[model samples]
Target: MRDTLRTRVRLVGATMAVSIALLVAVESALAHEEYVVDGERDVAVGEFLAESLTDPFVVGPLLAGAVLVLVGIAGYLVVPPVERDVGAFRAAMGEYRSYVPWLLRISFGIPLIGAGFGGYFISPAVHVQARLLQVALGFLLLFGFATRVVALLTLGCYLIGVVVRPILLLQLEFVGGMLAIALIGSGRPSADHVLQRVAGTPGTLYGRLDIVHDRARVFQERIREYRTLVPTIVRLGLGSTFVSLGLGQKILRPGIGLAVVDKYELTTVVPASPELWVLGAGLAEIGLGLALVGGFFTRASAASAIGVFSLTLFALPDDPVLAHVGLFGLASVLLITGSGPYAIDRRLEPVETEEPADAVPEAA
Candidate 1:
């Protein structure tokens, strides 16, 4: 039992390590279609949708894929996991819970700084300079100084920009990143933790100087109970982002997707027709997005998202790496949190009842 538990822990660690590696390695190909492809050259949306939808080749495969997914879901719900294995896995994962806030901070911080320096407004596609605002927010988030304040500021900026330029919606995952950070606050190794310690310590120089620490502590305490919603918020935000990208960017606007495929010569990599490539990619994203939103197989969905982001980087040499840094971080957070609260996984968990002390133990 101990050996099996150890092996599962090692496997989980290895999977996360590889996922992070892939995210870091695929930096060269991370830019989105809106950044490179010219919008004026795009085909009419009506024409593209009609042609793609009517094609038997595309529709047939998509239908079949949907059916397979439905069947898989049914099977998963009917089959029960080994209770011992589930317990071991959950125990292994429980140790990482404290790191969730740190993960959320890094995920939002770096991308925000990149966007500021890169001359974008929360999204790579929206080329509006708010460098000072974003950079300040990013630095504060990374430093874990007034982290919740910074997160709220980040969300506010993104929302205001969305009102001005609806295209900013492409990077909707920022919403999740910010909300999660706001809820979790800066975990250990942050300036917030250090400041809190100093302010709480008697006769410390920093403690005497700290004016807002008490108020901040009060605020953090009030919100701590709601932290469990972090995972659900992340799932919804990231899932919707994926759904929009798949449907709006690819299926609804194939001209742009095809341009990307042609420019990158993606056909050579997969040996498939350009239409199939576009359709398949779109469908795959939608499937992954739905799984995430539903919180079904949450960890696997997140891992797959990380894989997809990395694969895109490898496939598209011109894709800007900074644009996707946040996405990599958000997916990593999901990998850590799994399907927190209100998830299908939660409902699927087996109930455990206490056994009498006199009950005999069964042999493994």
Candidate 2:
């Protein structure tokens, strides 16, 4: 019994070490190609596809690695972690439910503000700027003043930008983050909460003059029932964004992706051909996106998304950090919330009698 336990511990440690090494190896190739590539393809389309898709060196390892990962995941599902420990973790994460609004605000606000000052749209690749509009919206969100309204306003602006410049679609996670804030409303440590408290007090000066307080409260109450959809909305938004980037930018536009790989000399970093780098990155992103979209192993997928974002930042310093901020925040939200309703994970795992402790509860 003792030797079996020791062997299991060693196996777990070795698995972790190998996983980390692989993650680091692919970090550079996994970065968003548009951030660095000038989009002029030096390689021909036919050659790039043939080399990337047909090369045995790349194809064999990718297939083998995927099989190993899937088998490991299956084993994990068959024998999940200790139930008591999982429960404790869930309870610990649950305590932070009230802070979701604040997290969303900061995640998006800083980036918007930076974008305004940096003279770019939501993405660094898009150079057009609306400093005043973005700054105002960002500030209001950060202050948590009229949060839901501000979030809606931000969404409107993003949609407008998308209409004008389709490239803004790359930052689609903003829609999810904004919609989440709109649904959840501002929690504590916000101007909304402070004013609400003041308006409720009998003798407060501001309370006497607060004309819209009661209406706003009523509206929030009315929408509270649908707030449970926050995670689902977020998953769709982020997942769609990922699929777009992977399929539209990388897979369909392999020339541009290959250009990025060559320009950065990324092949040297991972010792893979430029074709393999581009293809692998695109496929990895698509896989992650599909996982989120299906809500299969939702929490793990969210965590992987966050890790990918972090790796992208490190591998390509020129990649606009601001553009990824909303995505990072949304993934963080998922990490805390887990799979909400309509998740495959629910069907696979025993459906808890109650929601997971991490489910985003109604905001205070």
Candidate 3:
């Protein structure tokens, strides 16, 4: 039962995913903490705010924490044995010249750290338990200690935040990045790397863990190859969403599209009837969507998406505008990392049959 680096990473990833899923379930269960202020009384909000003190809400964090600990142990034990070299993938990643994944993590994590600290310090004046929770989890992430556990908690906290101020829901974009870090480790310049080194990674613990490092290395490499498809999946998702919305304009929500033209009174400004304007806009949306899903002209399409979403934001009222800011972030990211490895762009490159030893799996 010796665990290779590949096994360790996979186990950690699965554990984190399951833990987050459990946390989401728990969060939903306690989404609205009502209380029996008087015997058999139900009040959504009260003068005393007693709901937070009730048994179910009180135990939510404890329940989530317990579940993660169990998941961590179970994940450590059941990571499927694989044949692969973790270093080989690392080397391949470096050789293939794909540092966008790492860059994404670093960029996302750094700002989040600043925001977390900001929230932590500002929270005490209010004497709210939520801010204290934010502070504790913030420190955990800042140092990368039990990274996934802290990330899941942070996500749970944000979920609660979204409940309190529904406007905060857009901030879940930040949470998605945290969850990614949780599943993938802190991605260099973090405590996880230092700890791995101290443990004599790929060596001292090998005999104790009963892992087949050689086979695991091979398995890890296979995962690395397939991993390139991940970004493509996201790209296609962005495209498909636009495509669906555009189609919906024609069939389901034609009036909404027409309203955009009429509400703005673009008939004289743009020299087009509302019907014609809506039709053209829908076509543009569909074109952009096709380009994105196909992974063709990635940068242009992503940039266009950024423009479209941004302009759309201006026309939207406050609530919808808040929700859309996340979409803008997603498009911004796509603009930075176009098409990625598994894309139509790849087919245009010279045939590459030789798999390099330095290939690294994309961060989960």
Among all windows of ten consecutive residues in candidate 2, which has the lowest summed lDDT? Answer: 18-27
Deviation (Å) of 208 in candidate 3: 12
Model 2 compared with the native: what TM-score? 0.85
Instruction: List candidate 2 segments past 4 Å from native.
Output: 1-33, 42-47, 81-85, 353-364
The best candidate in terms of lDDT: 2
Model 1: ten consecutive residues of lowest lDDT: 355-364
Candidate 1 versus truth, CA RMSD in Å, comes to 11.1
User: Would you list the clashing residue pairs of candidate 2?
Assistant: none
Residue 7 in model 2: shift from native, Å? 52
TM-score, cand. 1 = 0.80
lDDT values for all models: 0.71, 0.74, 0.47
Residues 4-74, candidate 1: write the lDDT tens digits.
55654453344334323322222222234386665423577677667777888767877887899789767
Model 1 alpha-carbon miss at residue 61, Å: 2.8
Per-residue error at 158 for model 2, in Å?
0.6
User: Distance (Å) between predicted and true CA of 145, model 1?
Assistant: 1.0
Model 2 agreement with the true structure over 2-80: per-residue lDDT tens digits: 8755654453344334323322232233333266766657565567677776889889778987898799788878887
